[model samples]
Target chain A: MSHPSPRRTRDPARKQAAILAAARAVFAERGYENATIREIARRAGVTHGLVVLHFSTKEQLFVAATTPDPESLFKGVLDDDVTKLPERIAASFVHRMEASDGADPVIALIRSAAGDQQAAKALLQTLQQTAVDGYARVLDIPDLATRVNMMGAHLIGVAFSRYVLADGPVAAMSPDELIARLTTTIRTILFD
Target chain B: MSHPSPRRTRDPARKQAAILAAARAVFAERGYENATIREIARRAGVTHGLVVLHFSTKEQLFVAATTPDPESLFKGVLDDDVTKLPERIAASFVHRMEASDGADPVIALIRSAAGDQQAAKALLQTLQQTAVDGYARVLDIPDLATRVNMMGAHLIGVAFSRYVLADGPVAAMSPDELIARLTTTIRTILFD
Candidate 1:
């Protein structure tokens, strides 16, 4: 005489989200090498077998953890050409990155991909396409691909070194300083 | 002839150099994650036990491996005033890096220390001392400690993302482009 259980149907979605969250956390803490399927399952409060049953392996889980926001990352930057090209591109990159000050989950995914060639290629291709396509569509310039790529490198590289690596001088900079200085530098690179 | 055989003592130095070279190559190719003592020994054309006898452990070997020209790293950069700081720092840093590009053999040693917290600390401390001691002696700057640390983070983070992680756009830029853009961007941060 029991009512139908709400937990049974909703459990899958909840479990999936939990698993993904666990994957990101574990990957960040352990990087790619030390992260294990059992640890992820434990973090998610699921059984080890359940993780295997769902994703098959650590690599699969790593890939899945990154699946949700692919299109959004592209769309966020691409469609945000609300200002003209150089300013929008430079500002948006720093702004969005600065937004992730306390919560840069994408960094772990990106950094871990470096250890695996195939994963790196996938991430790299998507990044290049989104940046190149967005810049080309939004602006009229010579060497669109090269200039965009170079400017993009300095922006992200500077940020990564300063914020993520907490590399000294850069980490000391306030976010406003970061955005202003970075934008000014990259603005010239992109336009002038 | 009863020879004064300096060659008698020379072989050990030769062996040490060979081991260092092998360790560097192995560390760079596999990074900290995949590198192993066995593989390094194989590369050195020495037995595993020989490596142990010489180095005691991988950790000791790593410390020994980080010996580069620390004195030269900031020598040229701090020679001038604040206005010239950015480009000077960039040139000297990149010059040191570029000069050692192929001849630099301690990469595996550095990579090995990346994740292990104690090891990361040791490596970081060495670099920090190098930057501060050198920069403070040469430059007319205040807040040398903070600047040294931040610069370390910036350089390390940038190097990891650009070279080791090969993060898309960061990976694509040439050395000249990297130095140029990084130099300009680091200007505001490096100066008042």
Candidate 2:
């Protein structure tokens, strides 16, 4: 077996990071259906082989690029004081919107899932494992699962209006307004 | 100009209705991207010319087929007693889900809007003209527009979870359960 050359081995981690960032941009711009791996590879300035090596398929790449670190997000939300949990959750969502500069993975996943079965599965799985299960695990209340799911539904709608549709009053609100509007309702969904 | 024969004189209204129904099914099954006018014509048993004659473009047909009569829906929702208005609104949503037999036009619109700009515009316009404006016109409250928009956002999210995602606890709820869960929250968003 031939050993890899120094050029091939040099800064693999940096190359992987570059590919992920490129994938996110391409997915956001072209959407899931129109987004291509070759385009992603070209944008990343990496060979097609390298992109394939890092991400076996476009679906996997799409998921990886669009999905937030659900674990970290939920953990941070839950780790806060219970009285402040809703505020923290709202803040985290705003932080995600700001961090992504409006290319939110959850919104992307929802948009792609609108037409693609695989994306739909990824969306359901992500929400279930992240928001629904994450909240249910910590909060003990009657009809917790249903309430959490409803909360997820509400947030998904808000995201759709503000980000996807990008019109109407919900879309017009500032980030501070968004957080203010959502915090009370989110609290109501979880606790009341 | 040549006079049309009796064979060409079939009920125009009936034919238009058939085409719209076929368009809805095709759009629902194939979504906006993959759904074809040709297939819709075939399903409707009309010539492609007839389909085009009725709806000039796929986008037009998509808008027509997927958009509920916002005027009627909101009029009906608003005409009721103010005390039971929330329950009526919730019931109307459930009634829509039931009437469509699971191929919900609003959900289809939301799903398509996720990836398509025109659909996004349609979703926004429909919500703004129908729900936001309708509610704001009827209810005199502080921040009425923002409150109504938030209410729209919440309903859109609930519809997404229950219909599009189809796997969460919200999805598993019965129609009555859905109405019961949604009524209180919607009331809160509008009134509180």
- My TM-score estimates for the predictions, one after another, are 0.69, 0.87
Compared with the real two-chain complex, what DockQ does model 1 have? Answer: 0.26
Task: Name the weakest run of 10 consecutive residues (lDDT summed) in model 2 chain A.
Answer: A1-10
lDDT of 1 by residue, A1-192 (tens): 255332232478777777888877777566666678889888888888988988987777776774435445545455545344444455665566676542334355334532454554454445556667766766677767666655644554455444444545555667765666555555655655
Best by lDDT, which number? Answer: 2
Query: Residue A28 of model 1: what lDDT?
Result: 58
Poorest lDDT segment (10 consecutive residues) of candidate 1 chain B? B105-114
* Candidate 1, RMSD to the unseen true structure: 5.6
Estimate, for each residue in B31-142, the C-alpha lDDT of model 2 and write its tens digit. 6777889998888777899989888998898878767776767657886368788898899888877677555676666667645678657755765566666776567777
Q: After the best TM-score superposition of candidate 2, give how far the Cα of residue B171 lies from its true spot, in angstroms.
A: 1.2
* Candidate 1: docking tier: acceptable
Candidate 1 clashing pairs, residues 3+ apart or interchain: A167-B150, A167-B153, A167-B154, A168-B149, A168-B150, A168-B151, A168-B153, A169-B150, A169-B151, B27-B108
For candidate 1, the per-residue lDDT at A170 reads: 58
Instruction: Give per-candidate clash totals.
Output: 10, 0
Top model number, TM-score: 2
